[model samples]
Each structure stands twice: as C-alpha cells, then as structure tokens.
Target: MDDSIVFHGPLGELYSQVKAGKIKTALQGSHTRPCKFWTAMKILSGIKNAVVITHGPGGCAYGVKQAYKLTNCRNSGAPYEPVVSTNMDETKIVYGGEKELRSAIREVDGKYQPAVIFVATSCAAGIIGDNVDAIVDKARPEIKAEIMPIHCEGFAGEYRSGFDLVFRQIVKLMDRPTPERQRQLARSVNIVGSKLGPERTEVDTDVKELVRLIEGMGARIHSIIAGNCTLEEIKQAASVAVNCTLCLDIGYAIGTEMRDAFGTPLNSTILPYGIAATEKWLRGAAVHLGMEREAELLIQREYAAIKAELDEARRHLEGKRAIVEGHDAVKALSIAHMLESDFKMRPVIFNFHPWSTEARQTSIDYLLETGLDPEVLITKGTLKFGKYESMQQTERELLEYLGGVDPASTVYFGSSLSFPPVPLVDLNAILNRPRFGYRGALKVAKCIKTALDYAARPRSWLTKQIVFPPNSGGLSSAQSLTSKLAQNLPDCTVYAQRRKGRCMMN
Candidate 1:
C-alpha cells in the first residue's frame, strides 16, 4: 500500500524512508506494464534449446514472440526459442484452461524437441486456477524433455517479480552440480542478470565486452543466469565459485539465492558502467579468483586506449546538466556519480524504483558517502513509455532544487521508457554500444557531446518558443502552454491534450 512515486525529497530522506521499509509501490496496468510475461520472454529468448509457453491469450503470447525476434542471436547460430500461448478465450477463462496449456506444451515439444520447456502463466491463468503444478507432474512422464513451470503469474508483482521467480525456478529445476564439477569450475563465475544475446548489440556493447573482460581475468563465464543460458549451462550454474550481477534490478535476487542455496559468494558491486566502476569490479572479481594481476593489466590496457577519447569528450561535456533515472537507486546513483566524477556534468535529479530491497541501505550509504546529492524521485511503477506528468513534476522539483537550470542544456541518461518530458540524451535503446568499462566511458562522453551538440543546433522560432515558453516557470507550465496551443491553434494539429486529469495522446 506504500506510494510508488515520490517527488521533492532529498537523497538522505529517500534513503531513510527506503531503509525504514516505507517505500513499496504497487504497479498499475498489469497488461501494459512489463510483467512476468515479458520477463520470461527476455530470459528465455537467448536459450538455444528451449521453448517458452505463455499460458495466456494469443495476443499476450504474440507480444513476447515478437520481442523474441528482436534478439540478435544470428551470430550464435542458435534457432530462436519458440514462444507459444494457450490463447485462453472467455470460455477457457470460465472453465479452466488446463487442457489447452497441456496441448500447447505437447505441440511445442513435438515440434522443437527442445532440451527444456518453460511454461509461464498469465493473469487470466492465475485467476482460473489451472492445475499447472499437477499438469507439469503428470506430463513429466509423458514428455521426454524437462518441463519446468515458471510460477510467474502476470499479476504476481512487477517485471522484477517475474525475474525473481524465474531465477528461483532455475535454481530448483537446474541439475545440481557434482563435486568434481564444482571443484573444476571453482575459479569460474556466473554473470547473472544480463541479456543473453545482442538485442541491443548495435548500441549496447557492454554485454559482449564484459564477457571478454572476464575471460581476460583468467576466469570463464560459467553461466549468464537466465539470459542466453541452456539447460546444461543453468545446471552447471551451481558449480561456479561466485555470481556477479551486471545490474541491480535483475540479478541481485539470483546472486543472493545462488549464494544461499549453493554456497556461492556474490559480487553485488554496482555494474561496471563507468571507468571507475569497471576498474573496481574487475579488481574485486579478480582478487576473489586470485587473478588480480591479469585483471589489472587488462584494465590498464582498456583504460589507456579510451583515456584520450574520454578526455576529449569530457571537454565538451564539462558543466553540462543531466538527470539519471533507473529501476534501482544503486544503479542510478552509480550513473550519477560517474557523470559527476568523470564527465563533470551536474546531475539535477536521480529517479529510481520505489521498492525497499536488501541493497537499499548499501546504495543509500554509498550515495551519502559520495556527496553527490541530487533530487531523488521514486517512479511508482508507471512503466508506460513516453513522458508522463509525474516525471515533469520531478523535473520541476529538480529545477526548484537548483534554483534554475538551462532546459536546453539538460540531458537525461536512462531508458526511453518513463523519461522526462524534454530532450533526453538517451542510451537505453542504442544497440550494441558499450555503457560500461573504459570503452563505455568514452561512449558516455561521446553521447553527452552528441546530445549537447544536437541541442545546440538552431531551431525555428516557433520551436524555440515551445522549448523556452516565456515565463512559464520552466517545467511547471509546460502542460498549460501545450493546452493553450491546442485551443488557439485551430489550423495546427494537436497531437496530445490533457483532459480530466488524463493525457489523451497517441
């Protein structure tokens, strides 16, 4: 029942609230939000030998199937994981769809002969109370492949809830490692909670490059949790000596669970996004595996190559204002710190998810220690894409915190989903580009430069009028001007308008 979104709060206050366990927010629009269905698709998308079955309507399943196509596993020579659905209709909802789900599983197995079959239920499936557990048990004897039912109902929680559920099931379903396997892979590590393939391979180079970095440290990547992992790889996950979470949102639970269940230590360091974070992660990971020297050498080489580029980009980025938002406060704080320390950009706001997790206190402590206190906003599970008024409120609050800032110079570094209503220096959708390590640091610098450069470009007088809107209190009256424009400009098309406290925009 705790509020999901919080605006106009200090970093310290937000941290205190999170620590005191007063910051839980329920997600809205189960169907629209990235629920368990989406999480299952993302995790199973990279597995070469798996078929995912969503026990839902055809429409629900189609979305996941379409998303699976976006993955760039072309180089891996792995066939796309088939995502099917039961296509639950009104009749199925009223009278249990257990038979339909069973049929889907059988069809997938007959067609694919996959090593494993993952079944994720939908909100409708959950409501009807299909005996999924009983079906899985009964079908195990009938089917040759391992049939694992992921108990991630759409309404169970948010995207993260599905992530956690999938990981837990993975631990239970994956074959337990033998003593020999454990010893043989003791020095190896698991990179938990990363995309299995190059979906954003064009813009996000960090995943592949991180694998290369780990291999350079004399450590093999034992498993990447659910992303791009086969049944065999997931089974061997228990053998690894340590688990490293790339991002706080997805892998924290997986790493923690692995440590608790299999005695694997977890490296819950903030993901290696910046030069400093990468060095720290590499050093820490290397020390744990007794490969510090190799890690240091690789870090030195990578840093040297990107230093000049980073410096040159920094010259253009200095004094620029930015706002960083993410699903986890820890990750957002890390980006904020990197922007301030490396690029010398001023972070006006730091928005994060509104949940109090085990890592919340640690993240808060680190933020306090760094002294880079920006206005903190908790996104109350409003996951729909495009700008929202709550986000604009945060921007206004940030403007208040800083007394005022050049709106044109400000940038946002995060996902396009739920970004502020302004020009954002977005890095989320850029495919295959590195956002971590020395090379990633250069990319960040270049992105800042590009955003600023683009902002500096001349615009029409009307455009400038819209961007700067005379004496409208920066962000406060933006909606007002937009409404007025809609009313007065009869000849011009009005794309979006606020009506009855709701946004009517296409």
Candidate 2:
C-alpha cells in the first residue's frame, strides 16, 4: 500500500472509497492460476547436467535465455541451452516445417548430449500447425537422452498457459523415468515454482528460510522443481517424501500431480511474504508433517529476527501508497497485506488480469477481513491510463495507460512496461538482489528506505522539462518557439499553439 497504489480517472474514484474503509466487492469469479516464473528458476537452480532447449525462432530462445540470465541461474552451473528452430519463411509456415524441426533436434542432440532436453514451441511454429510432439516422439527413441516437447508457444495464451503446458510435458517425462536408482544419502523434497530470470530475492530467501524451518522440523529438501532441478534430479523425484509448492501456477499443479503419481504429499500455500503470513505458512506445513514443536521453535527464531526490520520498514513507508503488478497474484496479494499490516500503507487500488478462483478468493478474504472497499479492485489487463495504443493492444499489457497522476507518495513494484510515466522498481531485480529469508527482509527494508528517500526528493527542473515529442506537422520553428515559451512561462498553454500549427501531441 505504498503511495503509488492509487489509480486515477474512473478507477481512481473507486479506489478512494476503498482507501476510506468502504467495503465493496465487484466481479468475483474463479480463474486458473498460471505458473510462477520463480518456480521455474528454482528448478533451474538445482539442476545439473540438464538443458532447457526452446524450440522456435530465435526470439523464443532469446527470451528463455534472457529469463535464465536475469535470474542469475547461469552462475549456478545448470546446463541450459536455448535452441531456435530453423528460420521458416512464408512457404515453411504454410507448407510445414517438420523436416527442419527434426534436423534442429538432431543437430542439438549431437552437440550437447544433455540428460534431458525441453523443446518449447514458439508462436510461429504453433500457427504453422507443426506437430512438435510428433517430432519429439520420433526423435526420442533415437536420442541417447530424454527429449520432452513443451508446448510453450508465445501466443498460446498467457504465461500461465505456457507454464501449464510445460509442466504437463514434464509430468509425462516423469512417468517414463528409468528404474528407481539408489537413493542419495539424504531424504529429498521437490521445490516447485521457480521461473527463469533473476531470483525473487525476497521470495527466494523466504523459501530458503522456510526450508530451514522444515529442516528444523526434521525434514530435508530433496530438490527444487524448476529453480535448481536437473534432468537427473527431476527423474529421481519419486524418492522425495513430499513436494512443497510455493507459487500457485506451475508449482501447485506439479506438486499435486507428483503426489498422485509418486505417492508424495503436496503442500500448497501462499509463499512467505510477511511475518504473519510466513509464520502461518510455516505452521501449516509443520502441522501437516506432524512437526508442531519444531515449527514453533523455528517461527520463534525467524520472527525475532524479522520483527526489527519490519518495524523499520513500516516506520519509513507507513501510510504511503503503492501499486503492485506481477504475474503471480498470490505474491501480489501477500505484498499488499504486508504493506498494509507492517508498513501501515494504504492500498488504494489493485490491478491484475486473467484472474483465478484461488487468487480471487485470497484477495477477497484479505479485503473482507481488512474491510477494504471493492471499488479499488480493478481486474483487467495491466493498468493503463489511455496513452500508447500499442501497449493497450498487447495480450500481456503492463502499464499502457498510465500517464499524469500524482500518488502523493508512490512506489511501482513490477516488471518494466513501455507506459506509466513513473519509474518501476523491478521486483525481479529486488528479489534477485536480496532474495527470501531474514536477510532478505533486511534487504527489502533497505530498498524501501532507498525508494522512499528517492521518492521524497524535490523534483528538479530537468526532470519536469522532459516530455513526449510532438508527432507529425514536421518540427516547425513555431513548435520550437512554443516549447521555449512554455519552458519560461510555467502556466503557458501549449494546446493552442499545437492546434494552430496542426501538430499532433501524442
């Protein structure tokens, strides 16, 4: 609930009611949860000798590569290879490119004898009607290692769709593993819900802390799903006693399926984002595993350490407003609660898209319990302000419509978008820098302090002078004269000049 959470225009008015403690519920419905990218990152972190090969054009491979690199998993020593399908021209798309796909597979296998290869399809390949599964099926028998086809075409749906498809394919591969190998010395647990790119330092640290709490309760983590899971570890997942799913998307499904198939129980919970929620999640897991005493002790220690930092963050950010945007609604909700509870920030508005039932319920429960106004909750594509038509057009629009509006005190938490004039405090970067745990909380506190300090600084003349350039009408001397005049006369109206010159002020 930082100062930046308020929305303007029609949505802004509704948010004001919510901020004033009015209770209202708008459209409430169920939605499917998408895979959390952090879960994928976690799997990638634990894996060794496993390679993730994206099947599609160069952009597909590049996106995956960038995601991996951003997560800092590259230094973790996991074998991830991004493979682009042959550049298909119009003929290939219209006719078919099975031959080219087969060749791409053969060439990749020859070069990197990866224990397992995940071939993720691209939007182009998907439209071309290529049977990626068929190609992988034919090549699987010939290859020395496992070749899994992931139907993660860009245009397949949302990121959630890609996660679901990838996980389903992974589940299929899990069923076909070689005979059970000798169990490693320590008992294992599968950590699900990591995505490619920089680790969510706050969430990751929290997860690790949760793992420690579990360990204190006499449980051990076998392997993390996508974060650090290698092909070999994934195949051997049967050995784990349980799968702890943190993120709702890929992790929950993978955990539930693994439980059914391998007889491993699945524990689903909102990832630990704040002190209260973190303790609740830890206790829930402990009780499920019959480790109440240990859970108590672990919570005691974690809370003691976290309380000081939470107090500090609250002192600095309390009563401030903020906007939270991300793929993981659960994470966003948890963040909202933390801001409201610990930092005393008021959540003026919550904007998200492709809602899921569970996510909606969680948000609803929190709002109801807190007596939050329903009008402040806007569920649609990313928040837009009515500028930049292209942003409004994208399927996964971030901040397309954000323009001139003051949040008094604001903080923007999420990935970067073309719109939204305000700067973004990339959650991915923040998470990666200080990831989840007691230390992570401290790190977040520091980040909050920095952001608050920066936000409080007086605006400079240079900052105010920056503006979007006028489109069309050619750069006229009159336009230059108008700009110069406007700069000198703070209250000068440029609209009249722009209209006189027939300039398009985009």
Candidate 3:
C-alpha cells in the first residue's frame, strides 16, 4: 500500500488498496497472460463434439491447439481435436478474409460434422473487420450443423474476457422452461464457470466432489455449464433451480445472465477448499431450498470420514508459517485461508499478480467478507518475467523473503516450479488433486504430511541446475565438467579454451 510496492499483511487490506485503484499493474506488458483466442479454445475444447475454426493465420490455431487442446485431452477427459484456421494471409487481409472464413466453416462442417462449430476471430481477423457473424450466418444456411462465431480477438480484452464471451454465448443458447418444469427443478443445480468442460482437471475431480455432496444432500446437478456438455444440455441450462459457482471469477457472468434471463437463483460462493468452506458452499444454496438438516448431516459424515487424517496433518502443520503461491489469486488465497483457520497456521501469500486481483475483484471481495484477509507479498521479479526469461529471480526473491525464517517451521504450498529451501507441499502432484470438499481435504492432508515427513530428502541436483541456476557464482557442476573435459583435450581450439575459462565466451 506504500511506495515500496511491497506488502506483507492481510489480503483484505491489500484488496482495499486494489479496489481503490492504488495498485498499478507492475512492469506493464510483462504479464504472460494468454490471449482471448487461446482462452476461447480452452472453453470450446471442454464441450463434447465441438469444432473451433480460427479466423487468422495457421500459427494462431496451432499455438492454441498445443497450449489447451492436447493438455485438456490428457488431463480433463477431453477428446483430441485439431484446431483449423482460415489461414489469413497478406492477400486475404488486403482484400478481405470473409470469403476464406465462410469456406473454412463449410469445410469443417463437411469434414467433421461436429455438433457446434465456433468461428473464433484472431487479432488479424479483428483488425480486418472480417464480419465473422455475417460469414457464419451465410455458412449456416449452407451447412447442416449449427455455426457460432466468437469475437475472441487476442487484443480485444484480457484472457478472462474469453471466458465471459463464451459463457454469455452458452447462456444465450438456453431453452426456456415451463412454470411447472421450473418448479420441479427447485432442488436441481447447474455447476457454472468451467474452463475444461466436464472432466478436465478442475472439472473432473473438484466437480466430482461437488456431485458427491449435492447427491448426499438429496439434491441433483442439472449440468456443468459448457463442460463436455452437448448442445441440448446447454439449452437446458435455464431449467435449473440454482446455479452453483465453481469459481465466480469465471462463473459470475454466466450466473448473472441465467438469473436475469430465466429467473434462476445463483450460489456465488467461493470455492469450498476445506471443511468450513465446503460447509458454507453447500449452505449457500441448499438452505434456500429448505435442506439445512440434510446439508448438516452430509457435512458431518464427510468430515468424520477424514477426521483422522485431518487431525494428523494438523498436528504436524500447526504453528508453521505457510507460504501460498499461484497465478490463480482466488484458489491460492483460499488455500491460505484454509491453512490459517483449519490447520492453525499463519499464511503468507506470494506472487499473486495485482492485475489478476483486479480482474477477480468479486471473488476477492467475497473472501474478505468471509474474514479471510491474509498478508500478500509481491516482488519485482514476479511481475517482470517474459516468456523466455529464467525463473531463478523468482526463487531468489522467495529465498530472500525466507532468509531469517526457520525452514523447519515453514511449509510451501504451491506448484512444483520453485525449489524453496523448506518443506514443499507440492500442489501440482496429480495424485493429490481435486483439492475440493472432503476428498480434497484428505488428499491435501496426506500430501502435507508426506512433504514434511520427507523434508530431509535431498533435491535432485541435476533438475535443480536446469530449472533454477545460481544467481551469482562460478561455473555450475555441468559447466565445471565441461571445463575439465576441455582442459584434457590437447587439440582444444579457441571455443574449447573459452569453455575451459581460459577466455571469456560471448
């Protein structure tokens, strides 16, 4: 909150400063945020049997496919589908790309015959004013399949904008319900705001846990909006009685649209990470449906199932300083809140970007309202990394922050990218995933216990050298080996001499 541009206190206080517009985007133009085109494809990939046609050069299509499609298929139960493009070139750009876009849509419909074909515009398409919607409308009459156009130009807005753009489109597809049908859906809920459709990373495990809780309370889930759902399912989204939030940062736009359009209620709760939060998540909507007792029973049963593991993890983790980190501001801070209140630890947040905080202000405001305003610490290194820059500075910043702290009493909860000199509860481990509800709580406990139990184990020197090099030092072990190898050769040339430290290498 001061000119130092560094803070080490409650998130609520920091968020207040953020809301007041005091926090500037650090090292502008340095955020490695994905563009709308890439993010739009991420949403489309989650829908079953949908095809996306990029209205740009081939590289845009290929880059997005590699970044979202393949990984989503591997992790989120999505199918592998190639992202095609109009292949907009200079000639097309000079005249117009509409003809190419129309052809691409029809070709895709003939070849794949997908349930939905989303024509996502790129920066080039947007710049050219390609009239993507008009092209889609014309192509729709010629093709049998439904054609939709997403103005997902990379330069149009933040990566998060892609989410709402697709979500609003998804909401628009909803079919209205009769009064009787709406009443019958009084106990039904729609899980809104998904990135990977149905069974993707967060969708698979986290949503499964939500299913368990909802069914246990005698409630039913209508559909997970856009998560591997079919065209019919999206149209039926309006029939749900309540829309339960998976993450309001992405869900709020869809949730509000459904509310206004169909008069459906929305449960805009933060993600239920721990015992208490999960309880709150359930009650946020179930109580309105007059299922308070049922929700309580389910909570008690689930808590009892994991009581032993929770107690054990807490015994080892209590009184420790928890360092929480992630690009996801809400999820990271939610974990921090759980560690503080549930596990009895003090959490210090790190590397949560200010722009991200601004984008997800609604979620952040809700967290503060729930009294979860933990301290946040940011460094210049966290804000200034480009795509190819080494992440050693980030690690060094963390090490500096922990300089005088006790490693034994400190635990790091984040991705496996950083090799902190302390016990690290690796959040990226696939086995301990779905960090939601009681299932997540159990997995988190086991992971924490393991990380602390194996705190004495040595890190792999080889991977460490590749991932995080020394900031200031002589040659590393690999370099030293190369130097020795160079020294042994009698026919060493100028390049070899440079490698052996006999001369400076450019």
Candidate 4:
C-alpha cells in the first residue's frame, strides 16, 4: 500500500503483469516506517575511524546506539564506535540546540579522536533547520578529525535513501589518487557495498572466497567499501582498477557513485551464491582485470574441493519443496535456482523484486534458463504478520498445490521477514556465518536437511496446541477484560483487536 515497487500475486497473471510493465525494480517494504536515521548511522558504523554524532534527542540516539551496539556485536569483534547524542530536550528544541551539537562534537572528538567525525542529523534537526554543514565547518579546524555532515532525516525516505546520503557523505572522504597510486589500479580492486555480521564477517563467507578468486588472478583487494576497513582503505577505493558489489541493495548505489566519481569500472552483478553464478561472477571480474585464466582455475579448484559435499547434501535435499522470501529479488531467485538445480528441490513460490521491468524480466529469464518457473510473489521489507489475512488465500492455494501435505512439512528459506506455515529455514537467523559460495551451498543443503527432519512432525500436533488460555474464549468486547488479562495467556496477542480480527477473517 505504501508505494509498492511491484506486486506479483501468484500464477499466470504474474507473467502478464510483468510483461505489462506493472512492476519495476525490487526490495524491502514500505518507505514510511521511519528508520532513515538508524540506517545512516549503521552505514557510518562500518567506517572504523568514524564517530557518529546524532543531532537529535536521547530517544532517537538511544535507538541508533542500540542498533550500533547490536551490529557491532555481530561485526568482526571490532570495538563499538562512539555514538554521541545531543539529547535535545523540549527546551533545546524550542530555543535551538546548535550549541549543544557543537559541544557534543567537541566532546566526542576529544574522547574518541577518530579519523573522521560523522554528524548525523535527525528529523528533529531537519525540522528545526539545524544547519549541520555550518556547524561542521565551524568545528572542522578545531578538531583533529575530518568532519562529515550527513543530512538524513528520519522522514527523508527509506533505508535505501539513507544509504545514498551516507555514501554521498563518504565520497567527501576520498583523497585524490597520486600518480603512484594511479599505477596501483592495475592490480588493485575495491569491494563496494560489503557489510559485516555479528557471528561471522561477510569476507569470511562471500568476500573471503571472492578475495581468493580475485587475488589468485593477480589482483589485490584495495578496499572493502563500507565493511571493516580503515579510512585509508576507503580513500584508496578511488584508485582501484575496478569495484565489485556483492549485495545489490546499497551496492548498486555505491558502485554507481564510485564509477561516476573515480572512473573505476564496476561489476554490479548478482552475488555468487551457487557454483555457476560464482563462476560467472569471478570470470566477469577476472575479464575486467585480464585474469580470466586465473578465475577459471580458481573456480575449478574450489568447485572440486566442495563438489563431493554438495552432492552428498543434494541427496538429502532432493525432491524437497520450498518457498523463498527476502529483500533482494535477485538474491532470492539465485538461492531458489540453487535449490532447484543442485539440491533438486522444487521451489513453488518466490517472493522477490527488481527495480526495473527489464531487471525483473532478466531475472525471470535467468530462472527459466536454470529450468525453474515457480509462482512468483514479490514483497518488500520485514514481513508484517499484521497482514496475515491477505496472505491466507495464497497460503491455502500453495497448500492445495502440495496435495494437502502438512504445511509444517514444507521448507522455507528466507530472512526473519517470512512466516510460512512450515519449518522455516530463516537465512537471517544464521548469525555465526553467511550463506555464500560452494561452502555456503553445502551449508544451505545441510540446513534444508535439518529443517526437513525437524518438520516431519504430525500436522495436527501444531493445530491442536492451544494459543490463548482456556478461558480466553472467542475474543469479544463482551468478555470481561479481566478474563483476557489472565497471566496464563500467550504474550503474542498484545494487539487483541487486530489478532482477533485476523483470526475471524481467516
């Protein structure tokens, strides 16, 4: 409802609608949920030597700070970066808090002395017209760190918009490449849009193998765009011979900006999830760097090492049925194809999106090429179970297609964003490591096997279990409020009205 990029509600109508140019592009849900400030702060978090100062109240800062702490906990054991807030109270809001912001910056710099200071303006600052740029300019000379002002109000746009603004601010950090550094471009490459996780680093999964594949071809990883890299590494990004973007969400924007600014060639292709895709991706990068032979050799070697395990896992995963859902349409599709091809699983429904009709068409073409033609259902962002009623019809249709097999028996692959009525293999839940490359393929196969084993329970077992307490009785206003508030009731029903309404509708 909130500016949908594309909508493909299962079946032949999907093909028709896609062809009709009804949906263009893809990714996360409504842009109205108000997370722009948090998004910007997360991006700034990846900059190792940067301290983010939010020009807003304690509430906004607290949320962003928590997000920082959580993401940092997931990162490569890096110490949490300093995030200071002006804690703008009502008095400061009415009179103005520019002086408070200035003081916060000074205090933060004096304490952290980070190489770069990122000033993140919140919706309050934007509404009050706090000129962050002027304040940064005024404080630039006094602070030893370079100051960067990010104008990302919570109402600015969505997560993607925050990424754009953050990257724009990061661009100012690029130092002009010296003639000597320009020569470094021949063997140097920049990894754009790489992110770190709590349990394992992305480089350990996607970038690690990628680095192996590229460096084997005589290329050096000059920088990982927004990952755990130093300010110096980021500045060197401008001098890299080419840039590779693994995740398309922010990768596309970062690659485009770097290409436009530094004239660095970019490989914004889909991430290498499966064997074939990884081969294609590595070859693409190798060709640009004139290391096609090296790429092929590396691919062959890695494939040989993991092929046995993949095949064994495939034996357990074959004939499995599943539904794939997540933010990136292309990534979801890639995973779907991997399931269909190597694992020999049947993917009945795919929820993904592409920003352009052309991109969607291309994705569809790729799926077809891989012999996967599943029912497509595109969605964005976090899957809000609040819209469960609307999903019921689709759920029934899918269940019927499964010949009444217990929904619990089906496999689900996605982030925490999906709530399929089956054993869900929440990809996002895997915190310790990422799913990528040949190793990742084997890991997924093992997870699918585990999910199938766990889901072999009787279907009625789940339905027979009680949700609300014994006396909760068909929820109605007439029911005494005290009865509904019984201590034994499930904590899941915080929204009594919405949940009851959805239950009745179903």
Q: Pick the candidate with the highest lDDT.
A: 3
Q: What is the lDDT of residue 80 in candidate 1?
A: 61
Ranking by lDDT: 3, 1, 4, 2
As a TM-score, model 4 comes out at 0.76
Estimate, for each residue in 56-136, the C-alpha lDDT of model 2 and write its tens digit.
455545554565543354444433454344666677778877888788778777887777766655667778778888888
Scored by CA lDDT, what does every candidate get? 0.65, 0.51, 0.74, 0.63
Per-residue lDDT of 185 in model 1 = 89
For residues 1-506, write the lDDT of model 3, one tens digit per residue. 23323655677777777778777654356565788877777888777778899889989988988876776677655567668889989998899888877778878889998888988889998998988887787788799887788899999988888888988887766788777777777788888887764454544377787987899999998777767778877877787768888887888989998889888788887778887788888988786567889888888888898898688777988888888884677788678867876888888888777776777788888878877778788776666644212355566677777876666788888644457778776554433247888878766766666656656665556546654556634223333343343333222011211243221111
Better of 3 and 4 by lDDT: 3
**What's each prediction's TM-score?**
0.76, 0.65, 0.86, 0.76
The runs of at least 3 residues in candidate 3 whose Cα sits more than 4 Å from the true structure, single-residue gaps closed, are 1-5, 19-22, 27-30, 74-82, 198-204, 386-390, 471-506
lDDT per residue as tens, model 4, 190-262: 7777654232445355677677667766688887767667888877777776778776546777778877877
Candidate that scores best on TM-score: 3
- Shift of residue 345 alpha carbon in model 2, Å: 4.6
Candidate 1: lDDT over CA atoms? 0.65
Please report, as a residue range, the 10-residue window in candidate 1 with the lowest summed lDDT.
497-506
